[model samples]
Target: MHLHKINKVLICILLTYTVQYLMLPFPDLSAEEGVIFENPYKKTEKQTDVTQFTIYFTKKSHLIPKQDQVRLQSVADFLYRNRNFEILISAHSVEGKTNKENVLISEKRSLEVERFLLIHSVEPNQIRRLFYGNSKSPNLTKEHEALNRRVEILLQPIG
Candidate 1:
């Protein structure tokens, strides 16, 4: 009779411990209601006045033609038409190149784009330059990889 009572107590203790363990909160718990996500295409009232453009580069050519100045002029006019908008220029290169070379090329491309925008009357303060050499590429082909070696422009709404 005493052994049977002890067995019952042990079973109850085990069940209670199991339940408590199951009810414990996880360390990495996140509240669903507190999470916030950003939308890329959906413009808010805050973003009402920004236009963005991207320029892709190939090994063949890196410069916007000095003779054909309309391209740069158009970009400048677009920015002027927008309110509180700034441009972020990023340059990317493909993988397989040495880190040293990649960094050099990416900086060169970013600077080149910045110069073009500056010459077109875009304010130095309004432009932000970035570079990622052989780091981020959409197309991962040997031939098409060079296409990734390009400069991208992002127009952001500034408050």
Candidate 2:
């Protein structure tokens, strides 16, 4: 009878250890904890990538300076690579002497970018333009005023 009791204790201890070993390996992935179980068998969809470019201007200057010509050429290369993409150029001016003068400057800045792209053989049809006169920069700081005078080129993929 004493031997019988020992056997029963050993069985209980073995069962306890086995239960702990099995339970420790997997976490409780219940919905209550916001743990999601992904289906490993499912496939993923392909995605397209869009690109953007920016060019900053000097105070009261509409020309693309000699230093920036290489940068502009790189952008032209990207445009050529993605032939189906459309370019949206938003030109902005720094705080100027007058609103009218600022607006004119902004237009000239956009035209200069457009002309540069055209000269690089980018299609005119792929380009759309907008200009913002001495409107404040999204970045509001005295130093960023030079940054405010700029063009934002947004590239959108076509279907």
Candidate 3:
């Protein structure tokens, strides 16, 4: 096949896979009345976001967008219900700052997220935090700098 035809075939395959993955029901852990689940992937009538997600922040800003408030509430609810699950929240900031200032910005972002979770009744012990300032961020162009300024959330079931 010609190089162009091969490229088109590769792109088609990737797009098809992406669509299928998105359409399928996510492995949501639905809780009812304080019951502990054996399998998190079990499907249910009412699904909540029990998976990992990101909270993005604007450049040099620690505030979360108003639109993401609802989503964070859902996460808070999930963590409150599943006491055996633990969440790691790592706050990050964009490059081009002194280490002291970078850490300060990330710290503010962490506090904001932790406060939200606490207000929603999530147990303080169920949460873990890390501050990764511009130190961990890779060198990137102007357009990609926004990607580095974010708070990444990860979830795992505790023993």
- Winner by TM-score: 3
Q: Pull out the clashing pairs in model 3.
A: none
Better of 1 and 3 by lDDT: 3
lDDT tens digits by residue: candidate 2, 5-71: 9999999999999999778755665334212122122232221222565666778888886645666
RMSD (CA, angstroms), candidate 2: 16.8
Question: What tens digits encode model 3's per-residue C-alpha lDDT throughout 1-159?
Answer: 599999999999999999997777764644473232322333222324447766667778888777467778878888888999877889888653687888888888988988888999989998899997877776455666766777888878875
Q: How accurate locally is residue 95 in candidate 1, as Cα lDDT from 0 to 100? A: 49
lDDT scores of the candidates, listed in order: 0.63, 0.73, 0.75
TM-score of each: 0.56, 0.60, 0.65
Worst 10 residues of 2 by lDDT: 33-42
Residue range 74-134, candidate 1, lDDT tens digits: 6666666664777787877764358667767777878887787777677777778888777
State the local distance difference test value for candidate 2: 0.73
Position 48, candidate 2: lDDT: 22
Ranking by TM-score, best first?
Answer: 3, 2, 1
For residue 151, give model 2's deviation from the true position in Å: 1.1
Residue 108 displacement in candidate 1 (angstroms): 1.1
lDDT of 1: 0.63
Candidate 3 Cα deviation (angstroms), residue 60? 1.6
Give candidate 2's error at residue 13 in angstroms: 91
